[model samples]
Target: MEPPDFVRFGRAICCDLVQASRREWWLADGLGGYAGGTIAQCLTRRYHGLLIAPANPPLGRFLVFVKADATLHDNERNWPLFTNCWGSGAVEPQGLVHIESFRLDGSIPVWRFAIGDLILEQCIWMEREQHTTCIAWRLANAVERPVHLGIDLLVNSRNHHADTRPYGFNSIIEGNVNRISIGRAGGPTLHFHTDDGQLFARHQWIEDFDLPRERERGLPDRDSHFCAAHMRLPLRTEWSGLVATMSTTPEAPATDSPLRCGEMLNRRRAHDAARLTAAVTLTPELHDAPCWVRQLVIAADSFPIVQPVSAKETKKELNEKEQDRQGRFGQRKESVIAGYPWFGDWTRDTMIALPGLMLTTGRYASARNILTTLAGFVDRGMVPNMFPDDGGQPQYNTVDGALWYFEAWRAYIAVSNDVAALREIYPLLQEMVSWHLRGTRHRIGVDASDGLLSAGDSGIQLTWMDAKLGDWVVTPRHGKPVEVNALWFNALMCMAEFSRLLKKDAEIFETLAKQAKVGFSRFLKPAGGLYDVLDGPEGNDDSIRPNQILAVTLHYSPLTPQAQAKVVAETGRHLFTSYGLRSLAPEHPGYRGRYEGGVWERDSAYHQGPVWSWLLPHFAMAEYRVTGDAELAQSRLAPIHDHLLDAGLGTISEIFDGEPPHSPRGAPSQAWSVACILAAWVTLERARPSAREGMAKKEESRQ
Candidate 1:
């Protein structure tokens, strides 16, 4: 299992501080915990850490271990193998210059450093389903004499969202030669273990570590880490590593020897291999796809995690089989984290990303589990908008999440054809429609006269363009938004189809779909394109936005062929960029070119001008639908292929600057951005000459 060529970087990239610091790598544990940092091995965001695990099982994350600052020691001299940005604007050690090359060895970030005569390698990864992180280092080549490593084990226990103060709490450190335990009293404990290393308990407060990225985001710019201990280990051609685990409760003493670093590497490699194999077996189109697309297949595996079920939710109707599974695996469900660093499982993002992140990658069980899990939280005809990080009740503030749910289910059935699952979930789907047709929360209900869904109020944003700061809803599209109604029409049509498949009455849904289609025509402006919102406080909004592209891209588009083509052409003429479609046309008076400044400033420009990668797929699909040119449509996605190496390393960023030379911004790794791109790519592939031929042969054999 070799990594894709596009992901590997040489000294030209790895040796430069600016470039290396911008390229981040992330690894997930499949339990909603992760390890990530820049290629420079410097902490940029407060979220950058070697170990961040859930203190409350999935979302209540705590950064337990900051990093293991490493130094290489030879006969007479030594050099630091890590980099740190100081508060006084100095980069000490400047360790990035020592790197010979950097590449993701199948999602694990590996860096090779030219240390005098020896080449040293370092890599970090997390164990799946457990709160354990491993950092392994090796002497890639032979050395003249014995070369040792001095590792300053920096540890911290702070809410991942909060900054730390020096000695904020007293920590008790007790360890022997090969093991160490560091934790604050009555809090989580971090157990550090190694196969071959000498550990010594030490305490020092390293403060004033500058977080440049946080400063850029207008946040607190300084942090501190407690040096809990130090370790000395000799590097060999074979791997030697340290493992750290967080125990929220009491645990038994460790008598077993730590697993060898080589074994851990092999386990991760085997898992990567199996994922690729299963993906190809399930979706054969990927077998001959480009390397970047395959790389995305590996990237897609990072978002879905096991969200622990709450005590209240677990008391819902459960069958014998469900109870047994819960008893064995603990009470947990599947969900997708919307983005890394500072996002929880958002329903809209999860459903919007489902087909791409799950179905396209042959993760049907995970897909079903995610849908089922979210289904349990549906209320007032809407799925919970997001799961709060503090383990509070799920928020239900979105008008389109439920609409996207219908589409997610439609995508699932299109691939799996599992009628039994559809039948089981159909009733709840019907209830969702009923709630929308009547009145639900947030004034969300179908207008009796127009049949279009209306939602939102003062100071509220219910659409994906949601960006708020204090009481100011930046994109408060408080009415029947173009995309929301488009989704409504699509959802109604989906219900009609699902009804037919399940031997239920389809006439009502069919009639509603017809009514919504008729109502949707009001969005078509006389000058072309569609309105951004209708029946708002100020009447119809004529802003040219990417939201109207949904009118043509969805599975059950209500627009006619001519109308769809007009919308596509109008959007391309105004909003299309190399990376994605801009949120607002530059001609608009309110458009902001750069998504910079502080929170209020950024939120104001968030939907006003920034180009969203997620909408690029919608535009691509719309263009393909209108022109029937799958190759040309897929070419729209070309800019992002190189982008995989730029921002999040193998993943995609949440958004980009609306201007030229679109710089990646926002969450480094976004679920919808990657999901939408891969889903559109696979979809466009089906219309290719080769893919069509394959499908024809398969169809002929079935006949």
Candidate 2:
């Protein structure tokens, strides 16, 4: 896959190490595994590695190969080929000075080094759904001298989250004629097979590798790695020149060269692009959509992986209230890894992300598998909130997670028309509603008087604004959050509509939905927009937040058109930023303008004023509905296309600073962020000119 012209960087752009290190590249292996590092060839984050495999299905990630330090030998002298940061705060080797340019060949990271007249190219790629990594160095151009290269493999055997210090990690390294196996007792045993090299076993411990990014996140900043071996290779460009495989499994030495791997990688990208092209129905009409959208479709494919569940053993794993849900857990199902570096399969994020990531890319089978997988995990009428970091039992503390499932189904059924599948899950859906009405865990239940959902109690953060660091519930809109109720109302309307389609008792749901509408009316504020939360012990929260936009954007909005107009206008006046909608208006006293510093500081401002990318699509949709102008609404989302280059290479970020220029922060890659924008764009593409023409009236009013 040749690199996109716009994404490629030259020496002029990446001339400084600081600038180059800020630009990171990621490669996903489609099996809850990824390989990533900085463009400057420095391991800035602990996540930077050649192989970070899912040790247990999709959650237990182990960083097996940290990086390989190598040098280019031109007989006269040796040039450092890799860079590292030590605890002394010194950048060793300084390889960025030799890097002429860097680019992503599709998802693969490529670095070109120029030393005198000799030029060498290096790249890394992971096999599809496998723990195998191919690290290839090609001698692209050579001078009169015969160039030689020395590589030292830095190996680690620990969970990605935990750092390593000098320990009794006696990593046994054994070498054969063509292969070398490195084993850490009780940990993973990795095999390295080189196409052409003279291998020598060497045991050396490197320590105090300072991780700046980890320090920023308030983690152990110092790490150590075991250098397992050293190899020398004569530089040659022919065949898969100087190819090596560092993988979980043993394989024959590669004779097919790195060029062939490049070919296969390009073909894979082409196949991905074709799937997106076939899925798009509005291509000719909205033919001008930016190039990054298709890249997002490709990026979408990276997150979902096959998470096999044993239906029988789940009862022992979960609490007694989850017995019914555990009965059918044995299945090879699809689940999404929410993001790279750090995240697990989260039901709320997965459901909200499914349609845009899967359906929009015409990956119907994947979408169905994901929906079915989450459906299988429903317990006490609530879906699993998040799978713990180590593949442990899922936590079900979220009130909004189950509600999003109904909306996900609506989005899926709209495209698939899978009524048969709908019928199969109808009873489960009914169970969910009953559980919510009667009340479930965390005080999440329909208040009998208002017919509206009320969740959370003392010290419990139930809603999506759930950022609590050690009993400090930051931005806790515990009781009847605006978006939660909107979703609750939407879910009730869905139940009614679905009951009608199935020819079941629709009256109960219809009545409950009407009652909810009346209860929801209490949230409307005298000033404008709606209350952020209602019926709290403290009465009501009148923060001007983006949450109220959902009342207008959802499939069955309970708000009147006039009220919807007010919400949209208010959101535009305060919450809207070019990057996204801020969690709170900047005018608020509690508002934090920037997201930075350590973990607690960042989480403190997480929901206070950070602009969330996922909310942009909702605001965009609500604006379109209010103005009846698809073009204008679509234009609002256009700026995000340019943001793709800012962070995550070609995908959207989780959040940005609430202030102007809106620096991207949080998870560099996010599921809901990509899903929301992709879904919204597709909606705009399908939008027809309204029957009521208000373009001129809207323009005059704006003026």
Candidate 3:
């Protein structure tokens, strides 16, 4: 039987073609980048090219190549290409490719390419002992094809940078160029000297590539920001596809030397050719039709081809069952297709995305595998927030990650109603709660005064609004953030519910539930309704942020109906943006209007005043529950859903500028945003009678 199709694996807006042996993958959009452990660095600074390659092992060396034509060039202005070359490196011209290297590291050695008017060819080769991963890019010359690309690699790195505190790599252009000018155009662009015969290479490498040293450095003033790379390759060939080659040295070879050339390529190709082909065809549906309500369908004729799965196989059957379960809970996107191309890291994203993408789509056992994969990383009761690409230790900086785990657990139970898994996870869940209460890294501790959780002010912004500029915390709520409390309340309730389901420690569950109820009551404010935070000792600062919505939307919440209603009303009134809920209200002094510009400028807008796409579903869920107006909730959610469908295809963006029709910011395919959307979509479909009746009453009152 053929392996499952790429679209059937999980719900992903974009897919990647990974040449694991080469440690590289090309995103669906034309840009290609390196896949280092826990990090994905963009090789190209601009979207002008169609190919990117990691020219060194462990993704230390990076190179980007673009096809240029006189027709596309501007005579009056020299088109300057930006390359992010960190560390200490030198670039020189070599045959058809450019060789950039740092002698001590022996990472990025050669980036070779041949560019023509219509066709572009690029190759990246790196050798670390007997292991080698190579990626080649061949793009068509057609100008009318849709540009497949991504942005905001720098923003994503901010979380890591905050924890480690290291100087970020800057962009530099190499060639027979004398002058280089950097400024913000409509978007950010770099201009430099470019003569007809000028040839150049750029690279970004760390001076001291040690993780421990970087972590000890602790919170640098200015880290990388607003970094993006894109490619515009015209599709001309009917059978265009990405090719990835990978090979590792066998423990013992029959012959004295390692396998080379034909044998290696043949073996690697046999395993990955179908996947590379599958990546292009698995694009998800964009419409909001009822058919999509059950499961999102993938077009058979999309750019990347996808192989179908047979029901007879055990693995396939289990996968289908998981997908069906996810579908019931409103998660119906494909993820983890066998033999399909995929990135090695992004474990948190994969696990969080599993329910909506696999289980809801009818792949139960696959969902179990995803959960089991994550659960395996439960160290001292903390599941990994992210995994390093090179198989290094996992990072657990995210405060919400464990909470999401509980949500996934509940979601799994909602589908399978399995008591055994719940029982198995109970101890881990208890430990996580205890760890949070005891206070983990970054001063994330639970308040003994009130049961509300306190996080942040330790330079690490765990919650979204995560960007830090210099010494300034972008949206610093140094005390008890509203959302943290909401989550804390929900976590307690979920634990109580799970405990009851497993029939273990009913008294402990009751005690915990009562504590959550008390905490919720204590956090409420008389005037602002639900305060955004209760900082320090006094429960003062009543900021009207949308974090309060979680208290109402989750399966079990401690908030009373009146308090929930107040939260919904206040959030809608002050924080709601056309695109999404703003991280902070316009009334706040920290708010910034424009979200696009230079590095600092864009990040300043992020979380300070930007509308996050992920918050929409949470907002919609709260609004629907409080108002019982499905039509109003649906209307409010319509534009958000439509916007994601239109701008990001099947996926939701990370954030958008809070001003006007909020422009998108960050990566196009964000996990939490998609999860929330799926969750809300299912909730809307399984509309309760009370909610429908409430909507009718609202309409009657209006009449």
Candidate 4:
């Protein structure tokens, strides 16, 4: 099979420890489990691990297997093939010096190490829908005589969000010749198996492992892991390595059972090939997309995961026909994990990401599931802001989440045209609007006088600019937020259309939408563009932010053509960056250019001036609407195509530093970031000749 072309780095980057360590690779199992590490094979963040799976299905994640520090032994001399960072600021073994190249073969990360005449290749991947991670190494070239290797198997059992402590778990190690099991009482056990190896139990505590990335974030930088066993293995020309899994079911450890490394790797390759093939089959246009774009389509598969819903609870209030419809789709609902290594399934991110990740990629069923599932959880007309990581109750804090829900449905029905599903969900959408029209949690409701949505309270961050440190709410946009009303106006218009399509009375929705549009004029600043917030505690906020761009980008924009053009021009002039738009323009006094330092420092800068890649789609769409130049608007997204190779391989980062070089920060692989960019690119591609012709006609008329 031919290898997939996504990204590749040669000795120029692989040989440089700084450059190599900064570039990270991530793989997901579609079950909230993942494996990630730097190209240098060193653990820089506490989150970096070989296997991290949820102990509570899709929540309550635990770091199961940390790393397998490998060593090559030829006769008497020994060479460490893995790198480690120590607490005293020392990088030991410097294993990266032996590296020759690194590349991503689909979702799999492959590293090649050149040692004299022999070259060793290492790869890491996770099985789909299972908490199994496979780490394999192969001899790329022929090596005379037998080459022996020693691998120190490290394991940990603690909440993935916490810092590692010494003796965090009284791990009990049980191992035979080729199999090892490590766990504490009443906890999940990790089963380790190697195709060709001898395992020996060694429960040793290795402490003071330095986590530079954690330290940079002002988090706990020191960590400890238990070396549960030692494995001695032989290397061959083909492939041979280890598999670790937390599955203790009837089919426990079934992934690598055949015990052949070549077959194990082939299975992963085939699975990835099928994913790409299915994407092309669903969306034929993807067949001609650039390699990076296709890679993003594969990356898109990692975010949505199955979270089972209770039939009794979901159907308790529905009628027989709705129950039958729900049964047809099954009780399993999918949610888009906002971002990997940290974030949970956030409603705002899920809805905002639904179009690009699911619709653009042709995963219509999954998109429908997400929308319906979240609709079931809507309370007081508000969709959940976030579902807690512990699988507890969902939080309803954001005003924009439910507003975005309307847009997500609009985008879904545009693609799927499943009116039956729309009919089922339409009432729920109307109920949400009703709740907003009245009053809901977090002081989110429409203003009676202005007919505009007003949301937020003291110490509550209701909008997407939400970043909190202790009791302090950063970006406290409490009244008449620009995007919320933009969404409110857009939602009302969508309801009018949805009502019309369903043969329901559309007059009420149309009248409400018209009133909201007239009220939306309050957001327009006399100087130009829209105010960031109106009637706030300090009165109307004239801060130039990316939020105003949404007023023009949404399907039912309230802005007139002239006003829309002005907003786009102002945004492009002040907030536009190569990667995305800055959260806050530099001219604003409250703007913080760099997103770094401790919790308070970082949270303060989180929305102040960092560039959010997700907003690029809004800007791109708005630019297209104003200029009618699809090419110019599409060119705005060019930097992201190259960004797939940086920071996070084949995926996009959550945010970039507001300053130059725009160092990637926050989550390495963000759902909305990838989804929005791909969505905008596809949208622009479809608008093509028509957009060009529109511009040409205007030019002729002016002449």
- TM-score for all predictions? 0.96, 0.91, 0.57, 0.94
lDDT of 2: 0.78
Pairs that collide in candidate 4 are none
Best by TM-score: 1
lDDT, each prediction: 0.87, 0.78, 0.45, 0.85
Model 2 is weakest, by summed lDDT over 10 consecutive residues, at 239-248
Clashes of each: 0, 5, 49, 0
The C-alpha stretches of model 3 lying farther than 4 A from their native spots are 1-354, 388-392, 437-439, 537-539, 640-650, 688-703
Displacement of residue 247 (Cα, Å) in model 3 is: 5.5
Superposed by TM-score, candidate 3 places the C-alpha of residue 159 at a distance from the truth, in angstroms, of: 18
Better of 3 and 4 by TM-score: 4
Which residue pairs come into collision in candidate 1?
none
Q: Poorest 10 consecutive residues of model 4 by lDDT?
A: 307-316
Between prediction 2 and prediction 3, the one with superior lDDT is: 2
> Candidate 3: lDDT over CA atoms?
0.45
**What is the C-alpha lDDT profile of model 4 across 1-703, one tens digit per residue?**
2335769999899878889988999888887888889999888888899998987767778888999899988787788988888998888888888888999998899989888877889888887888989888888888687887899999898889898779767877776877878878767789988868888899799988888889899999999998999989898878888888895332335553564777878888888887778767666556666787788887888898886322234423776765665675557777878898887778899999999889887789889888887766677788778867776666778899989999999999998888998898887888888988899888888888889998777888899999998889988998999989999999999999999889999998898899999999988888799999999989999999999999999999999999999999899899999989999999999898998998888988999999999998789889999988887898888888788888888999999999999989999999999999888887887678855476567559979
In model 3, the Cα lDDT at residue 426 comes to 75
User: What's the candidate order when arranged by decreasing lDDT?
Assistant: 1, 4, 2, 3
True-structure lDDT of candidate 1: 0.87
lDDT string, candidate 2, 211-310, tens digits: 8877877777888888888878677774232233434433333434344544644555575556556555423322334566656665676677775332
lDDT of 1 by residue, 1-703 (tens): 4445568899999999999998999888888888889999999989999899888777788998988999999978999988999999999978888999998888888889996678999888887777888888998888669999999999899999998978798888877878888877767889888877889998899999988888889889899999999999998999897888888864624533446988888788778777878887898778778988888888888888876434345435656855554444324478888888788778899999999999999999888888877666676678888778888877788999999999999999999998988987888899999999998999999998999999987777789988988888888899899999999999999999999998889999999999999999999999889999999989999999999999999999999999999999999999999889999999999999798888878888999999999999999999999999999999999888889989899999999999989999899899999999999998899888878898779769989
